[model samples]
Target: MSERVILTTSSHLEGYRVTEHIDVVSSECVFGMNILKDMFAGFRDFFGGRNKSSQAALRDARITCLDELRREAEEIGANAVIGIDLDYSEISGGGKSMLFLVATGTAVKVTKV
Candidate 1:
């Protein structure tokens, strides 16, 4: 397919029919904040406010995960991914903060209805 892969959180796409079930694809990412970012985030945490650096890190992780998912789907000749599920966790310990994200979905070949 020449177009971008359709991604949906729902079980199915509205106007497309699944013609082939290629496989289930997943992408995982691990991210960490730098010392400066951590210091800033820690300061914000002390004040009980939103941490922009942490938020940006997570946003980047999610975007990277989705991009990887799309790449995998395309590699399998899939035009869409449905039933997408996202999992997020903080893997922090020993005075270090880290973020982990995983994205999973069913890769399928679809045709316009």
Candidate 2:
């Protein structure tokens, strides 16, 4: 994997774990994320206060989803994930946020060519 084949795409693959070392591409997508943040802000506003708890929760969820995506790429023998993009939206009746972590890159059994 030359890291040049990396692309941005959402994927949820099973049976994989993200390696400690990963190359995160620049973020260019905000459609899904804007929705989530707006929803969260709305909830907080109506409640007459800030909700750090909610913010933290969403953060964790996003990380988990992204990590899973990375793991999938690794399973395919990708040296690193590039052009990674993430989107997040509200789910669970506006009570919870759904994170969409997408990545595209070349998956190959690297060799000393």
Candidate 3:
């Protein structure tokens, strides 16, 4: 996709009008936490400070999911996505943990107003 797909949390863009409502598009990303990260997170939990590693991982996952969303929109001939939403969750069990991120939006074709 040569042109960048516009993304907005709002249902409408200020300067653009939607010409076509394509479909809902979504992307999911999951990242595993290694033992070292778990250990550091435990230390942070005890010491009461920010967990930089976990923060970075979440940031990376968010970016990846958003990028994938954009790609999906483009693949289906959408020029923009509206009402974008991001969801994050953690899955932990048996001393193993993972971060999950989901990005969703409505793909559409838009024209400048």
Candidate 4:
């Protein structure tokens, strides 16, 4: 099996040196809430409580986007991705809403320093 790609939010690794810089890699994930979840969220909003469904959806989307980002880095012959960034946004209209997540980073080949 292939090795897993390492991901880091820092520009440089602690004990590794970047030998080659590859192209930037990014991944996006979109998730939509069902009517039940929407209703729960609305109720939570009115009563002032945590929305578990929405939180779970956001967490799942984040994980999916990060996994896709790692795959993209591996495809380009990169063993690691540095300076990773994640962005989240919500799209809503006509009584519908979706969560959009994006993961971006610089793919690079690294060696032990």
Candidate 5:
């Protein structure tokens, strides 16, 4: 069985789902990744005027956050994460930099139609 299945927007399948709660599903997820462009965009938001520190901070944040999400999915046996939601926040303290990400989705096993 394929460990990771990437579903296109138009592709119709029976095993993909996006929701808060999933009950009685058998699957396994390996990891999740973002395209390079998206990683760059996240950094741009952190940097006010294309600064290096902000760029580096954002990169680290994204990596750390995604790692946590993937870890959670792996623990629960997810083959592929669908309906990804991104949440970001700016640090409140003066001169502080940080961001947060939470990924939630359903894990299901797909059988041939």
Candidate 6:
């Protein structure tokens, strides 16, 4: 199995030197909202409270996006990814609503300093 790729939002990783700049890698994940959950969330919104189900869906989307980003980095022979950026958006105005998450970073070969 491939090792877990190091990921950081910062420009650099402590104790690791970027030796080779591989390429930019990105991954995106989209999750459809459940109608039932939406109804519940709509009720909660009326009450001005947090919606647990929506939060959980957003959490899952982030995790999947990160995993995909790591796989992409590993495919490019990169052991680490730097300058990572994560974005989230909700797509509506259609029959269904969806959550989208995108992760991006620069893949690089790294060595311990």
Ranked candidates (TM-score, high to low): 3, 6, 4, 1, 5, 2
RMSD of 1: 1.5
Tens digit of per-residue lDDT, candidate 5, span 1-113: 23543322232345544433333222222222234534565677787357465456566665665555554555566544444444555533443333444434444334453
Instruction: Compose the digit string of candidate 1's lDDT tens values, residues 3-94.
Output: 79999899888888899999999999999877788898889989898988888998999999999999999998998999999999988789
- Tens-digit lDDT track for model 6 on 23-89? 9999999999978988998999898989999999989999899999999999989999999999999
Candidate 2, residues 6-111: lDDT per residue as tens digits? 3334232233334433334332221133555767677888987876755665666656655565566666556545435555554443544344333334333222
Question: In model 1, what are the clashing residue pairs, if there are any?
Answer: none
TM-score for candidate 5, residues paired by index = 0.48
Cα RMSD for candidate 6?
1.0
TM-score of each: 0.91, 0.44, 0.95, 0.94, 0.48, 0.94
Q: Over the stretch 1-99, how does candidate 4's per-residue lDDT look in tens digits?
A: 198899999999999999999989999998988889999888999999899889999899989999999999998899999999999999989888889
lDDT of 3 at 27: 97
Question: Each prediction's Cα lDDT score?
Answer: 0.91, 0.47, 0.96, 0.93, 0.45, 0.92
lDDT of 2 at 61: 61
Off by over 4 Å in 2: 1-43, 47-49, 92-113
Question: Which of 1 and 3 is the better model by lDDT?
Answer: 3
- lDDT computed for candidate 6: 0.92
Off by over 4 Å in 1: none
Better of 1 and 2 by lDDT: 1
Badly placed stretches (over 4 Å) of model 6 are: none
Worst 10-residue lDDT window, candidate 4: 1-10
Best by TM-score: 3
